[model samples]
Target chain A: MLEIATPFVKKAGEAYLLVLQRSSEFETYTPAVNSARELLVKMDPQAVPYEKGQLGIEYHRVDWMGLSL
Target chain B: MKIILGILLVLGVSCSSTNQKVESTATTDETEIQAPAEPLKKRKTKKQKSAVVTPPQEESEPLAEEKREDPYLGVKEAIKNANWQGLEGEAQKILEQNNQNIIALNALGMAHFYQGRPLAAKYFLNKALSINPNSSDVKNNLAYVTKKEGRSRQAIILWRQVATAGGSSSKIAYENLINEFTIAKDYKKVVGAADSLGSQNVTSVATLNSLALAAIVKSEFDEAEKLLNQALEKENNNEALLINMAILQLDFKKNLDQGRRYLDRISFLGVQSNRRDIVTRLEAVAQSLTNQGEVK
Candidate 1:
């Protein structure tokens, strides 16, 4: 799986993340990818598995008032 | 800003209290003379003999009356009414009598300035400043005259001096500096000048726009974004600000999604008639971004 981390909702008026997934180009997953997966699962307990050929994260909010991601 | 500074100079000299007594004395003398005019008599013999002599006396009487009348009164009236021609004559008259009169010198400078004689304006304004080097009013006028004369570097120096002089004059100077720097394409200085005004003084949409443009010119995308965002906070529905933000995102930051988001906001805000071009440009940028993504 190809995991992408992008900013989601504000965490105390700062950037907080939501992880998304799609098909991976790599033949084998690295330790960093594994660790990110574990972190994402811990961050969002109800994480769903990636479907084949699905698009990655396509949306993020820009906090215009505070100018945070 | 230049127009406002010019108006302030005119009003400043017009309202000066230093020479009111001189003007009042002249007016009182004229009133005393006019208060004792004899009625015209019906004498045909006296009329023929007096007619020849009266022509010369009548001709010279106006010149004497003009000399005796308070030049400052005419200067004040002309300035109040925005009659540049009348101001030129009255100011010239005052200067002829006393070249050291700072008020008359200022008036003469402003009269030439309003009449589109920048060189003449500079001459008289320089004379005034020579006499009273600390007069912020004269300095401001000289700066504008210098700008009009195409000596923007000198004008910028004078404006900076006036800006440091403080008060409403400083505000005018800041505005003039912004404009001159913009024309000079010295965007770095523009940003510096705007920042020096501090947040409270730099709250206007125009100033914000200038700061943003300056940042953009320097290719400082983050600073541009901050300034644009601050301006947007003040005028969220302003189409120009929306368009600027959209362009900044798409062209400079290369953030297609953010650009599209701003474009969506602009469309929802209802594009003004004059802003149709910006909308068209945004749409073209969005299309180009989509095409680029497809190519990738």
Candidate 2:
């Protein structure tokens, strides 16, 4: 099911950036979140990493149409 | 254009089948674009008499020629050329003549959908659905809109209906369900849906394999084994199934030799290099399990 991907947000210095998963579920959210956790902890010192499973992201699948008249 | 036609031709054949037997569509982790695969002429719409525009009496001789040439040729060509705006204009023109034209309604819904307007897309799709409740095309498209609107649970219910109803686009709907569940990491719901689809024989090898993986994640080893065996019966050469079986045998079944047998069957030749690093990693894990011998 290479239909869609998971999403995550990361902190780049003072600003936070959102990374939306446009394709492929294989890329996953854990790695991205893990990196973000590292950056967050540097700033807060008490920030925690996301545990394996449910990343709290919701996704919408792509639908295609043609002149299906 | 050739590729779209060739794909449409193939999907046209698959759509005609009750099982929605698209062997390639059921493939696990191929990372290839799928579904949109069912777009274009795969829609088996009935010709509406009122959709035809009438010609004046003096020009009636060429009416047959005009009809044969297709009044909706612009709409069809716009769709073929991937011109959503053109399709939107043509569909609006058709609807201006006959408000009951399902094709125009569908095209309008699709055009709006492509243009990133889910609300508008829902409007036309619902209109089409109101005209015919049984249309898998409209229902499936509506399901996409509902999902896009962030109503995934509702979308699942709709997809389940389309999948079990057994139609041309049932396979695509079913695959969409698998995709949603996988992304959500909702393995429990996936197993539930797979069981329901399995009872109807509408589920595919990839889905069963996915269900098996889900079962494994849930620590439902027995259910995982059952699903893996079911999938293996259909496609013995499938790497996903074999790898899953190997994991089950070695880690859970405590049968390293059986695991090795399943691993031996995998060649990695069929694995897509662009996105199948997981499969490659699994190969290493299987090798490590075999090398380590029996372990608790």
lDDT by candidate, in order shown = 0.65, 0.63
User: Which runs in model 1 stand beyond 4 Å of their true positions?
Assistant: A1-69, B1-83, B86-104, B165-168, B199-208, B214-246, B252-284, B291-296
What stretches of model 2 exceed 4 Å from their correct place?
Answer: A1-69, B1-67, B133-136, B187-287, B293-296
Best by TM-score: 2
Positional deviation of residue B181's Cα in model 2 after best superposition, in angstroms: 2.5
Task: Give one digit per residue, the lDDT tens place, for model 2 in B125-176.
Answer: 8998899888887788788887777776678778878888986667667667
DockQ for all models:
0.02, 0.06
DockQ, prediction 1: 0.02
Ten-residue stretch with the least lDDT total in model 1 chain A = A51-60
User: Among all windows of ten consecutive residues in candidate 2 chain B, which has the lowest summed lDDT?
Assistant: B42-51
Error of 2 at B65 (Å): 5.6
Q: TM-score of candidate 2 restricted to chain B?
A: 0.48
- Taking all chains together, each candidate's TM-score versus the true structure is 0.42, 0.43
Q: Write the per-residue lDDT of candidate 1 for residues B114-175, one digit (tens) a residue.
A: 88887788888889889999877678778777666666667677888978888656766786
Clash number for candidate 1: 0
By summed lDDT, which 10 consecutive residues of candidate 1 chain B come out lowest?
A: B37-46
